[model samples]
Target: MNSNKAVFDSLRNNLKVHYDGKRFSYKSKHDLKDKSQLLVLIRKFPEGIAVIDLKDAYPNVMDDLQALKAVGQIWLLSNFDSQEDIAYPNDPRMVIKVDDDLKQLFPRD
Candidate 1:
């Protein structure tokens, strides 16, 4: 399995977390206040699909992606378009679809 595949598999088997109206209600009782992204996702996904977005360096994204995979949830990382040329500002990271693979989750319509 490639990186994405390995991550997805980890997510599928490891994390048993779900969201419900401003409540994380995870299977584990451990607190995750230190994990900023996790906290954000928990608070923001009160009534929507759970997803984590990453910005900044690629290595950081790789690590967080792995972590999120361990938790068995879907996530997205975005990149900024070239600042020098303003032809297009790349695409924003938004939820398009949910699938077992990355290819199917894009081009959100």
Candidate 2:
């Protein structure tokens, strides 16, 4: 199912950088459809990667969900972290969570 190949192509062709003056650019080797793909993303952009509505992106993918928690990259979808089962209840990084409302990050979604 090529749900949205154009989006995927864009992501693959032009890797976005955080531009923290680090000049770091990332290449996404895989799509964010499953845990394995998420792991590839982690391996590619572990330091500064953001995912919005992570559940919508990788629904029912346990490995992807766990990787999000393990890597601490998916910030906007804080609902996942607040769950009682998660290790972190009150995340100290609540300050940055506000960016989730920006919506411009993943405009095509």
Candidate 3:
């Protein structure tokens, strides 16, 4: 019984360490699998797509845009505001487009 308890504790500790390591190493910005569809849509328009259109198509448009922007995978442009200004994703004037370097990753059909 004591030996079994010891083995269980050792396994638990090992798993905890492994989980912690993986959790820290994972970067949400770099993980775009869930946002692939959004990327493809953005890639379709070279000049950029309207944020309102994206919002209409994607329920989580803001989160997806911010995640892509965080990783330099996409750019959010607003004709009325400077880059430093906060642009609302729901605004019709805002545009979302894939980064030029990453354009190849999301090829248009």
Candidate 4:
């Protein structure tokens, strides 16, 4: 029983260390406050907000948008664009919408 308890403790410590490292790395890469604000703004427009509007409000919107996109937290949609045209963040016609999973995370007041 004592040997089993020792192994469990070792595993727990290892997991804790790994979790903390990931948390720190994530926080360092993204500004939680800014990301939260961006999410809330996007949530306001269920039909999706234009990239130009977001850029106007947040000058450095691309960084946060890209980070969120990389993690599957948001989607970029083209507005009446050709199928071959790639949606770019700088394109005013591009629309941004938050992922359904994240809608609950930033509920409207």
Model 2, residue 21: C-alpha shift (Å): 40
All models, RMSD in angstroms: 19.9, 18.6, 16.4, 18.1
Q: What is the lDDT of residue 70 in candidate 4?
A: 71
Question: What is candidate 2's lDDT per residue for 13-86, written digit by digit as tens?
Answer: 55342233434345232346676565455445434344432333445655555656666644323345543232
* Estimated TM-score for each candidate: 0.22, 0.28, 0.42, 0.41
Arrange candidates, best lDDT first.
3, 4, 2, 1
Q: Could you tell me which residue pairs clash in candidate 2?
A: none
* Candidate achieving higher lDDT, 2 or 4: 4
Q: Candidate 4, which ten residues in sequence have the lowest lDDT sum?
A: 22-31
lDDT per prediction? 0.40, 0.45, 0.55, 0.54
Cα shift from native, residue 60, model 4 (Å): 1.7
**Residue-level lDDT for 83 in candidate 1:** 25
How many pairs of residues in model 4 come into backbone collision? Answer: 0
RMSD of 4: 18.1
- The TM-score of predicted model 3 comes to 0.42
1-109 per-residue lDDT for model 3 (tens digits): 2358686455445522323422322222222344777776666566666665455343566788889777666777776653332223232235586688899788699
Candidate number with the higher lDDT (2 or 3): 3
**Model 1, runs deviating above 4 Å:** 1-34, 42-53, 57-59, 75-109
* Candidate 4 lDDT tens digits, 24-71: 111122223476687766665666666654553444777887786676
